[model samples]
Target: MDKNNNAVELRNVEMHFNMNKEKLYSLKEYFIKFMKRELRFERFIALQDISFDIKKGDVFGILGLNGSGKSTTLKLISGILSPTKGQIKTYGTIAPLIELGAGFDMDLTARENIYLNGSVLGYSKRYMDERFDDIVEFSEMQDFLDTPMKNYSSGMVARVGFAIATMTTPDILIVDEILSVGDFHFQQKCEERINKMIDGGTTVIIVSHSIDQIERLCKNCVWLENGKIKMIGDAKEVCDAYKKS
Candidate 1:
């Protein structure tokens, strides 16, 4: 495929995590083990030679069971983590809603967090100032603006995160199951916003346990199992196969 036409490309990607074999209670004990060369590690593979391509303006879904490395893949694409092996190339700016409230300060009010999260997402203070009202409106949390995020419910937090992340249309949007936290009505609102972004030419990568949602929003889907690609192709076909299995 043409490079310019693709929004994301992953080639032979692999992710490995090292698990410590022993726990030390203190720095002194940890130093003793290091001096003795007694530190041991076990390697766990999270993704194995995974390869895929997402074209510009496409809504792609990653379907997998728990521990299937779907979240790992998204982290790699978002540059939150590096793959142990292989290359990932992305075109355009990214807005990641992978972890709700990851950029929030619990002690800060919701009003304060909007700018905080906006800065983390690469927007300047002046830019966030311009969009503050729009963000608050979309979040429907104007009443709670002065309330600390720590006091907000999970769903409320998710709403703020979603609002900030989608306040502007990015070239690529990555979402990871956060929509499930919202009530049915809010989820609908979010889905509509996502759909609008897609129509405006944003490429979206979503990881969801909801097969119905994957089929409804994604044109192409990949099924991951045991850190490998189990199936990839048209969303309906792949999802149907996964359902049967």
Candidate 2:
């Protein structure tokens, strides 16, 4: 596709993490080891030279098993974490549902977080105020709106997060694995909303382990393995190949 038609573009992206190669029993042991020049570190590459294009208004899918860097890719696009190397370009506003409580403050009440999170997403006060009721209604947390976010269950936090992210159509909507944490009813409602956004011409990127869901919603898919892209093409074709692997 042409560059003008792309909603997201990633080029040679790589993410790296430094980890202690060996574990010490305690700080004292670690100090002793360090003093003896015995400490070792490993440079782990979570994503290796990833590159892809998400077409405008398309439902793009990322498929991989655990530790394949699916969530890391989303974070780079969302601007939550910068890429250690390479470049990422996004055309418009992005709403990201990457993980549970990712952008929320634990001590803040649900009511306050609605605004807080909205602000983080670049929504103005007036904008969030207009959609406040809709957010609470969709999440079904009206009763606990005053409760601190730390007290909310994982499912409840996921509900609120999804509601705020999808309250209105964003140019780029990125969803990770948070939908699977919701109950069946919540999941159904969320899918319905996603379908609505699709009709409204929103560009969506989804990372899911569910092949069926990917086949149903995505037009193009990328499969990653061992921090590298194993395949990229039609959703069904990649999913079929993934099942065999």
Q: Hey, what RMSD does candidate 2 come out at?
A: 3.0
Q: Candidate 1 on 83-177: residue-level lDDT in tens? A: 99999999999999988779999999998999999999899999999999998998899899999888999889999999999999999999999
Q: Estimate each model's TM-score.
A: 0.95, 0.87
lDDT of 2 by residue, 1-245 (tens): 34498999999999998788766779998999889998887899999999998899899999999999988888899998998999999998888877755789989999999999999878999999999999999999999999999999989999999999899889989988766988999999999999899889999899998889999999999999988999999999999999999
**Candidate 2 residue pairs in backbone clash:** none
Cα lDDT of all candidates, in order? 0.93, 0.91
| Residue ranges of candidate 2 with Cα displaced over 4 Å | 1-3, 22-39
- The whole-model C-alpha lDDT of candidate 1 against the native structure comes to 0.93
Worst 10 residues of 2 by lDDT: 94-103
Give the range where candidate 1 is weakest over 10 consecutive residues by summed lDDT: 17-26
lDDT of 2: 0.91
Best by lDDT: 1
The C-alpha RMSD of each candidate to the native structure, in angstroms, is 1.8, 3.0
